[model samples]
Target: MIRLVKVSKSYGDTIAVRQLSLVVNQGEVCVLIGPSGCGKTTTLRMVNRLIEPTAGRIFINGKEISRVKPEQLRRSIGYAIQSVGLFPHMTVADNIAVVPELLHWAKSRVAHRIDELLRLVGLDPLEYASKYPNQLSGGEAQRIGVARALAANPPILLMDEPFGAVDPLTREKLQAQFLRIQQELKKTVLLVTHDLDEAIRLADRIAIMASGRLVQHATPEEILSRPTNKFVHDFVGTDRALKRLSRIGVASFIRPTHSVKLSTPMKEVASVCERCHWVWVVDDDGKFTGWLDRTSLPAANSVRQAMVVGDRDEITITKNATLREALSRMLGQGFNSIPVVDEEGRLIGEVSLGDVEAATAKMEP
Candidate 1:
């Protein structure tokens, strides 16, 4: 758990943060977001003593952070930034092992921790361990930065634009991976970003900042539908409903009952009927291939030939995709529904336009 009480930071005459108070609960992800120069990142740096508060107090698990040594405080709190900050001379394994090694972990323990962290961030230790930072791509280095931060298993994490350096597609993948890792590890997280979409997608609570002040703090649903002031409302934008969709995942609205395998006899595939008017098709490996029309398929034709098939990226939404993404696919392709697949393209479920509309209807005021 992390808490900041009346926190303020000033450099000469300029105020970086003013009376900014916020709390990040245990195992929760609290995102700080706003326009440029809004003090969101300043507030995060104050948490792990990267920036000393000019006046207020910061606490980590009930102990005041100022009372602890800076180095010690940092070691107990994982920090990742936009630039990645990996030491160019150090190999990937050595970089991840830094915190654990500093903690005096046994050589064997540190080695194991390094490998575990590399895999957690979606890299294979065998392939990446001996490589230097310069050998990695921007996205790969960002992942390594995250891996190093988690190397010590710190209960608290501070991320300042952690995904900001990567391309949009890679940024999305990193966000998805971070969400998955958070679900399993449950570390209390404070992430700073100027991106409203990222905040809505990854936060349990969003803290919106402006002019070095905390403008609003609430769940993404509340923030989207019930902005506290004019600044908050306009900052959230005119498309608040679309922003709300970022908080709803495809998994929540998935309809998994109407799928048939490529090997399924046409007679069996033709027998099923759903109001959506089509059934999803998958290979023997369960990888989603396409969809078949329920009304026209003949008992003699194989399921694959009669069904619509296109580029996987163009047609399918991943199980972790937001309802907004599902709706976009449906509207762009002019479909009543879209299939949801796993990372491997396996059919997991389908989400209809109705499902996304219902989710929007439930947004709070």
Candidate 2:
């Protein structure tokens, strides 16, 4: 755990941070966010003593950082920054090996750790180990930077815009990888980013600041649903309530699917439709194939003639999808309800627009 007591930083007459106190508990990711020159980067630097605070004490795991040597203190904590900051001359494996080698681990242990971290960040060690930073793409280099940060397996990690440099699609993939890695490693992380969506997706708690002061600090759901002040309210934007949907899982709102196998007779399909206005058609394996409505039942004599053979991808979403995504899909397809499927495309349940509306009503700020 990390704690700050009345921490402040000044540059002669200029103040970068003012009497801010915050805590990031064990196995939590606390994101610091604000506008440019809002002292977000300064606060992150102060944590690792990259920039010393003018007043107040900072402690990590109950040890005050001011009492420790900066070199030793830094080696014990991991840091990753925007622009990647990789040594242009270094290979991927050598970059990841820097810290472990500093800690004087055995040669074989360092070699094994290099491979372990590469795979952890979703890169292949055998292919990437000897590759130079200059030869990699923006996304690949970012992964290497993350691998290097986790190289020492430090209990605490300080990341300053770690995923900000990549394109949007690559950034999302990197964020997912970060979540996967965090789930396994459970490191205490202090991350800085100006992007609210990224913060909402990744942070366990968010710390909002303005003009070098702490504006609000709370869980993402609370901050969005109940902003502490006007500064926080506007900072989170008018879409705050909508963003709350991302926090909800599709499984919570799932309803039993009304479906029939393709081999079923059209009369039987029409019979199944009596329980519901819409009936879904699936293969013998139970994979989603198409759907037909009760209104269309009288137009055909056989199941093949009545069934609307359409792309399943256009009509189905995985059970792992969030309510926000489900809502978006429902609107796009002109659907009041849609089928939920497992990884293998077998229909499991359905989610309706009503479910999304009910869940969203409770998120008003």
Listed in order, each prediction's TM-score against the native is 0.90, 0.83
Tell me the lDDT of model 1 at 52: 86
Using TM-score as the measure, the top candidate is: 1
Q: Which ranges of candidate 2 are over 4 A from the true structure?
A: 258-318, 332-334, 337-347
Tens-place lDDT digits, model 2, residues 1-365: 99999999999888999999999999999999998888999999998999999998899999999999988988878999998999999899889999999899999999999989988888888899999999899999988988888888899999999998889768867987898799999999999998898888889999999988999999999899889999999999988767888778799899997888878888788778989888878888999988887888798786667788857767888876678768877898888888899989999989999999998787654
Looking at model 2, the pairs that clash are: none
Off by over 4 Å in 1: 256-279, 292-307, 342-344
Candidate 1 has its poorest 10 consecutive residues by lDDT at: 267-276
Question: What lDDT does candidate 1 reach at residue 212?
Answer: 97
Q: What are the Cα lDDT values of the candidates? A: 0.88, 0.88
lDDT of 2 at 73: 89
> Tens digit of lDDT per residue, candidate 1, span 109-146?
99998888888999998999999999999999999999
Counted clashes in each candidate structure: 0, 0
